[model samples]
Target: MLKRAFLPPADALVAFEAAARHESFTRAAEELHLTQGAVSKQIRHLEQRLGVALFSRVRQRVLLTDAGRLYLHEVRGALDHLHDATRQVMSFAGSQDVLNLAVLPTFGTRWLAPRLADFLRQTPQAALNISIRLRPFDFELEPFDGAIHHGDPIWAGGIVEPLFPEETIVVCSRPFRDRHLLAGPADLLRVPRLQLATRPMAWRDWFEAKGLVTDTAFQGPRFEQFGMIAEAAAHHLGVAIMPVFFVEDELASGRLVKLFDGTVEERSAYHFVYPENRALRPVVSAFRRWLTAEARSARLSRESLLPG
Candidate 1:
């Protein structure tokens, strides 16, 4: 067990953080609305508590020692977390529970945001705070109650509920398609191919699904987000392999055209993930139920659209 005695005072931590950030006790004191001597005293006390020299006093200037630099990184994170917790508690209203969620950027904008009105309608007492997180993070460190996770169900210390599988298809601007005279999957090889940085093997997988192989399957300008790839493809930059759900607007508006009839199923699917201890929370349970039903409906709708 960690000893409370090992912990420095919160005020001291704040003083240390401000001083380290500005490299000036006077600046830190000004920010904290305290005297320079008081800020210096707090830093000295903190250094004594931790048994380390945090800063070196130079002629009319202060510089962080090696230990101070390392401690600053951890201190900032702790202070930010404390601030978030304090804000959350202060914002609590009668009979209303706050649910913090992290979601992938493109997925959150296209899929989740559109359906959130329904969730809010169903749970009038629930308040949502959503943030974007592209990859998996520790639930303990982050303030989120749950996250919309893609790729796999491998979040440690969290319960993973399957949502829906991703179906990817090749798309390009209608003009590009007509200009290139694309008739089959093989014709895509002659044109520029845009790649998703996160899914480096997307194009390679698409070709493999069609029983084709090529050395240049991985070539193209790479983008970090699906939205970027879609935009680039829509402007006739290059052909892109996009998730069908994400490009529905583009396809419907004829901004981008599907190159073929078939869709490639990615190896991983989306999932609703939360810490195991939160499983019984009413807000969590309600959200999981709503999200599961929405995913099921979407799946059925998608399946109905597929040609037999």
Candidate 2:
């Protein structure tokens, strides 16, 4: 048999959190619809359990002790998480499952957002809640069923499923390309080259792929996101290396033009990642199958578009 965990009573925790927030037992009691004495009793019980004085009682007011302040921060976070989890469950009404996902900002907007309608249509029983997360995080701490990951497949304790490899190409404003007379990769050296801060070696790799070695690969105005870099390049700031999937709108609308005929495939790829424990979940499995199929179709379409 499993040993019982040492946890304070839920009602006491709730009372303590409320009391700590307002720093007044009367105010907390009013908010919780309890008498001031009842709120004080709950807090007193909590203090006894923890073996620490939570508040410093002055003439007629109460202030959090250092320990109380620290505990309040943690308790508040736990309460907020619990509230959110409860709300999420309640919101699921009749849905079979709700998949909470963490997605990269740009990827979420450009790629995943566009395809979500299809997923919704295909899996009518499931609902999705997406939040932007720039980097990988511990699944145990975060309230997420899965995450869309880019780069290496190195999420510890996660089941990483490859979505697609990223293919990037050189792009610039029409005038920027024409003004510089960039007929080949070497011509790019004369013009300003924009850089994505995340991929420092992108230009270097592209140049090396074309049999050219230069010190200028790392030189340029760096932006944190590809969207910013693409916008800068569109305004003739400089040529930017961007994923083909991201700049379809710009390329189609004539705002940005590809400078080269070929693309540089990154060593990394996009992945659908979830904790190993979720592998057997029906919702997770359904979404994975849908996503991987979509990825495969996208890859085939891209391949067909490439020059043979």
Candidate 3:
């Protein structure tokens, strides 16, 4: 026979436990909304099933026997565990499909923000939550379903889906460009060039990519965030290197002007990364499909608008 089959009925165990706590059959019946005889009969039935005397009639009150005391300890723990398990299952049922994502702060605001409405409209059933994450984080330790990684496609412990290559251009206020009398990429070395604290070698890389040599490539006022650097450049404080899409608004409004003939492609590209061994969640899959399609369409549209 199955082990569960040997267990007594839950109702009888509950009745006996109530009567044992109160030490009075009448009090137990009042709590249970039954007659005193009903509580007494349940205790008797439980005792007969277990083949042991579970209670003793003493001084017109009910007292637990040695066997009843031991059984009560185990039954109380079992019932509490069952109640907790049920509650947890119900909570999971309500929120099992919510997708949690970690993203870079600037990327989330500039690139992803404007495009998010399309994804939401396309996949209305999918619920997504985004949190700022600057660098790669441990999936085992963090409560994230996936992440937007700005660098290489190789995440140590996750699967990577390619997003796009980083295309950067030098930009500054229109007045700065005219005042400096810049003729070529080489002329930039003489002016106050801005630098990203995260990419100290950006100026040097851009210069070298144009086959120019200069010792002043590393010298500049470094800023931690791209937004701050872009703002500084827009106000004619210095010239800054920025991604094309990031400064599209500034360029369109004539606040910032792009210099040079081409963009400098960063070594690492953007990617969507997630734990390799994680079970595929419905909401996450829906988001991935929508986001990739949006990215592709945006790229094509931008390329078509560029002058040949």
Candidate 2 vs candidate 3: which has greater TM-score? Answer: 2
Instruction: Output the lDDT of residue 246, model 2.
Output: 87
In Å, residue 62's CA in model 2 sits off its true spot by 16
Model 3 C-alpha RMSD vs. true structure (Å) is: 14.2
- lDDT tens per residue, model 1, 107-137: 9988899999999999999988888999999
Candidate 3 C-alpha lDDT tens digits along 182-290: 7688788889999888888888888888899999998988888788898999989888989877888888788988887677678888888888655377677887887
Model 3 gets an lDDT of 0.82
Name the regions of candidate 1 deviating beyond 4 angstroms: 131-146, 152-160, 175-181, 273-277, 302-308
Give the winner by lDDT: 2 or 3.
2
**158, model 1: CA deviation in Å?**
5.6
Angstrom error at residue 181, model 2: 2.2
* Clash tally for model 2: 0
How close is each model in CA RMSD to the real structure?
3.4, 4.7, 14.2
**Candidate 2 ranges beyond 4 A from true positions:** 1-90, 303-308
**Any runs in candidate 3 off by more than 4 Å, and if so which?**
1-96, 304-308
Candidate 1 TM-score to native:
0.82
Top-lDDT structure, candidate number: 1
Model 1 residue 109 CA deviation in Å: 2.2
Q: TM-score of each candidate?
A: 0.82, 0.72, 0.67
